[model samples]
Target: MQSKSGTQKIIMHIDMDAFFASVEKALNPVLQNKAVIVIGAQTRSVVACPSYEARALGVHTAMPVYQAKGIAPNATFIHGNFGKYRTFSEAFFEILYNYSELIEPRSLDEAYIDVSHLVTSMKAAHALAKEIQNTIQKQLHLSVSIGIASNKVCAKVASDLRKPGGITIVHPGQEKCFLSELPVEYLPGIGKRTKEILNQLNIFHIEQIANMPEKLLIEAFGRTGSAIRAFASGEDFRNVEKPEESKSVSRSKTLEEDTLNTHLIHAEVFRLLEECSLQLRQEKRNCDTVAVTVRFSDFYTISKQKKLNFTSNIEKELWPTTTTLLQKAMHIHKPIRMLGVTLENLYKTSQISLFDYPFSKVKNIQQAIDKIRKYFGFEAIQTGRTFQKV
Candidate 1:
C-alpha cells in the first residue's frame, strides 16, 4: 500500500531473532533446540537475550541471571562474545544490500530499508521480504522478523508484533485501525511513567490516544502530546536516515572482580575519563557535560552528571567533575562492578573560543601528551592517579 507521500516510500523493519542467544546457538550445534541464554549470570551482567525456547519459560532480556534461573533452571547460560556477533552482523547487512541499498542500521541486530524504488506493489515487497528472510535462515542459520508498512513507525511496530521468525505487513490505510486496539504502552516512545499518566486520563488504547482532544493532549503532555498523536494517526514523516557522526564520547570498564575498594574504583574512573577525553580530542570536539556511572555488585546502577562552565576535551579539567559525579553516584557505598565516564553536549573544535582557556599552556601540553600516547601507546604517558593500584 502507498503512504500519504504517494508512493514515495515503503519502509521495512528487520529484527533478528534472539540475536545474541541465536548467534551462540549457530556457532555451537549442541546448543540448538535448547533454552539458551547469552551473558554470564555470575557477575553484574543481565540476561542479554534468551532463545525462543527460554522465552516460552518466561526468561527475558534485562532479567537478572539470578532471577532468570527461577524460571528456566536448566537453561544454558553463556558469556556472549561480541566480536563474533559483529562478524555475523556485517554479513547480515551485506545480504540486506542485495535487496535494497537504502538501509538504515538500527543496531547490530536490526535495520530499516526503504524499498520503494525496488518494488511498486505490496505483493512484490512481500515476495522480496520472504526471499531475504529465507536467505538469512539458510545462509547464516539465523532467522529474522520483518515488518512492512507505509511509514517507519508502523513498520517498526509491525516488526515487533511477532518474535523469532514471523513477518507482518500493514497496508497504508490500515495503520490507524491496526494500532487502535494496541495499548498506549505499545506506542514507540511511551514508557511505564507515560502509561501511568495516560491511564490517569482514562486512556489505555492507541485509538483513545488518537482521539484525544489536541488542546487537551497538549495541555497534559506539553509538546510531546502533539507528536505522539501524529504517530498514533500513522503520520510519521521521518525518512530512513543514515547514521551520522557520534554526538558523545564515552568509555566504560567492567571490573574483573566486583570490589568495594574506593581506591581501585577511583583509579578506574580516572582511566575511563582519560580514555574518553582522548577520544573527544581525537574527534576534535569539546564537551560541556561530564557524567559518571557506577553499576553496583547487586546490579543497581546510578549515574550523576553536571554541566561545566566551559567546554573542554582535556582530562585535567574534566577530572573534578567526574570525581564529584562519582562521589554522588557512590554515596550509598555500594560495592562497584563497573565504572564509566561520558562526555556530551559537544561543540565543534572550530567553534571554541581561542581564549576559552585562560592558560594556553595547559592546552598545548594536552595536545603534546595526546600525540605521545597516539604514537608511543597509552603506557608511554602516565597520569599520577593511573600509576596507583589499590
Candidate 2:
C-alpha cells in the first residue's frame, strides 16, 4: 500500500556494518562476538576492515596493523580475500536490485538508492528500509545501517547517524534541521584543507557554515565556497547513478619497497595498465584519457595524463601515450613507492577507421587474445613484457 503525497526526491544510503570483518564472521560461526581484523596483502599493510568487536577496542580500518595490534591485542587477524567478498557483494547488491534498479554503488558495501517513485511518504520509506535491513540480517547474517532523506548527501550523513542495524530518516524540508548540529566536516567534499579554512573562521558547525555570507565565502574559497555553502544548506542535486555509469576505471599498487629501477617501475605500470584495459574491454568501453602516477618514497605523488584524438581500449593503441605519461611521472629525485595507471573519459566502443592499419592489426590480435582468455582464463595468455625481470 503506497501513500501518494508531495513530489520530492527520496534517496536511501545503505551501508553494511564492517563489511569485510562481517563477512569473515559469516563464514565462520566460531569467530562471532570476537574482535576480528582483516589485513591486506602485504604483512606490513594497514587494516583493511575491523569488526564491531574490534572497533569497540579502538581498532579502525586503515589504521596500521601494528598500531591496531596495540589497540586490540587479542583480536584475530584474517587476511582479506577479495574473491570471497566479491561473491557476498554480488548477493548483497542482488537484494538491493530486488527493490530498485536505480542504484549507485559507492563501494563494496555501500550504495545509494532512489525510492521516490515506489514510496510516497516518509513512513513508507522507513518501513521499506527496515524490511531490506531485516532481510539482509536474516538471510545473510549481516547488519546494515540506512539513512532516508530527500537527497544523497543528507541520506549519507543520516545513515552514519546510527550504527550497525539502525535507520535515520530526514523528512523533506528538515534537511537543515537534521544537519545543523553536525560538525562541518560531516558534509561530503569538506576535506582537511577546507576544514582548516573553515576552522580559521571559527566556522565549525553546519549552522555556522550556512550563516556565512555567500559573497565572503566565495571571495575566501572561490568556486568551491559556493558548493560548501549549498551543502551546508543541505542542497544536493546529484542523482543515483547506476554502478557502471562511471568516468574512469583505475588500478594502483603500493610496492613493497621504494625503487628507481626503470625496468621495475615500467613493468609495474604496464601490469596495472593491462588490468585497467582489461576492465575497459570487458565493459566494451574506450577512453580518451590515459594517465600515469608515481608516488615517491616521501609520499609526494604526481600524475600526468594524455588526451588522445580518439578513444580506444586496445593496449597497443594506448601504449605510446601511457609510456609518455609514465616517463613524465617517473622523472623525480625520490625513489618510487607507488604507481598507478588510469583510463578516463570512457564511453562504449565505436567503429574505428579501417585505414588505421596498425590499430586494426593490434585490435584483431587483442580480440583474438580476449576470445582465448574468455574460453580459458586470463592467465592462459600473457604479454612477454609482463615477465621482464626487475
Candidate 3:
C-alpha cells in the first residue's frame, strides 16, 4: 500500500506453527503427525503449546495440563525445553536477517519484517513471502504462516487467518475490505472485556466498529476508543520497529505445590533473584529497580517494585530490596503457587565508584564465583539464604 509519502509499504508478519511442539517433532521424527502438547516444568503447569492435532481435539495453550489430558487423552505431553527452542529461534531470525534489517520480533516464534524496499508489487511480495516460508521450513524443518499487508496490524491479522504454512495477503487499498467481515476480535488490542462490551452494543464484526461514531466509542473506552476505531477502519500508521536492547530481565517459576510456608516461598524468590542477577551480570548490565511478583493458588497475582539508589547487578546489593518487595506483595496471606523476580531500568554497567568501595571486595568475590560457575555450573555453589525444604 502507498503511504502518505506516496511510497509503497509492504510488511510481512511470520508466525511459527505450534513452535515448541514443532521443534519437538523436528527433533524426533516419530512425533510427526502426532498430537503433541508441551507443558511447563511444574506439576500444575499449563499447556505451553499444543500441536494442530491436539488443538483439533480442543487442547490449547494456557489450558491446564489435566484439562488438556481430559480433552485429548491420546496426546503425547512433553516438558518444553526453552534452551532448544531458543537455539531454533536464533536460526529462524538469522534467515530473516538475510531478507531485511527492519524486523520487529513480537516473540521467539513470530516477527514482522518490513520488505517495502525489496518488493515492488503485490506479486513480488507474495513470491518473497513464499521464499521466506520455504527457507525456514527447509532449514529449520518447521512450518510457518505468513501475512503480507500494508501495515503491521493488518499483516498480523492476516497471518493468523491461515495456519501451518499458509500465506494470506491483503493488497494495498484493500485493508478495510479485508477486515470488514472478520470478527471485531480480529483487530489488535481488542481483548475479551472489550469484545464483551462491543457485543453488548451489538457490534460483532469489524464493519460495525468501522462504522461506529467516534464520540460514542470515546464515551465508552475513553481516549483509546479513537485508536480502536482507526484500527478497525484499517488506518494504522505504525511502522515495523527495529529490535531494541532488553529494558528488563525476569525469572519466574511455579512451585511443585502451593504452600503458605514463608521460608520456602522466600527461598524460591531468592533463587529467582539469583538467576536474574546472574543474567544481568552476564549481559554486562545493571538494574536500578527490583520487583517481586507472587501468584496465589486461586490465580490472584500481585507485584511490588522498589527503585534503588544505585544500579547494581550483584545479588547482595539487590536482595534486600527484592525481599522487601516480596513481603509487600505477599500480604494476601494465601497459598503461593509461583514466585518471580524482575530487574528493570537496565543500563550498561559503569565503572565502580568510590562510594561503592565498601562493596568492591564483595564484587570481586562475586566475579570469582561467576567465573567458577561459567567453568563448572550454577549449582556448584549455592547461598545459604536460597536453601530451603518445601
TM-score of every model? 0.68, 0.70, 0.77
Pick by lDDT: which candidate is best? 3
lDDT string for model 3 (1-390, tens) is 465567899999999999999999998899999999999977868999999999999998899999999999999999886656766787899999999999999999999999988987879999999999889989989999999999988999999998989999998899999999999998999999999999999999998999999999999999999999988988888988997889999999888999999888888888888888888887788888898999999999998998888888888888888888888998897899888999999988884522268757888888888776654456567788878753
With candidate 2 superimposed using the best TM-score fit, by how many Å does residue 67's alpha carbon deviate from the native? Answer: 1.5
lDDT of 2 by residue, 1-390 (tens): 112354677899999999999988997989999999999966659999999899989988789999998988899999886656755776799899999998999888999999988888899999999999999988888999999998888999998889988999998888988899999889988888888988998989998998889998899889888988888898888888885567998889888778887888877788778778877887788888998888999999999998888888877668789989988887777898888999999988764522246556776788888777654445567787777634
If ranked by TM-score, best first, what sequence of candidates would result?
3, 2, 1
Per candidate, the number of residue pairs that clash is: 0, 0, 0
Candidates by lDDT, descending order:
3, 1, 2
Of 1 and 3, the candidate ranking higher by TM-score = 3
lDDT of 2: 0.85
| Candidate 3 least-lDDT 10 residues | 351-360
Off by over 4 Å in 3: 1-5, 260-337, 349-390
What is the lDDT of every predicted structure here? Answer: 0.85, 0.85, 0.89
Candidate 3 local distance difference test against the native? 0.89
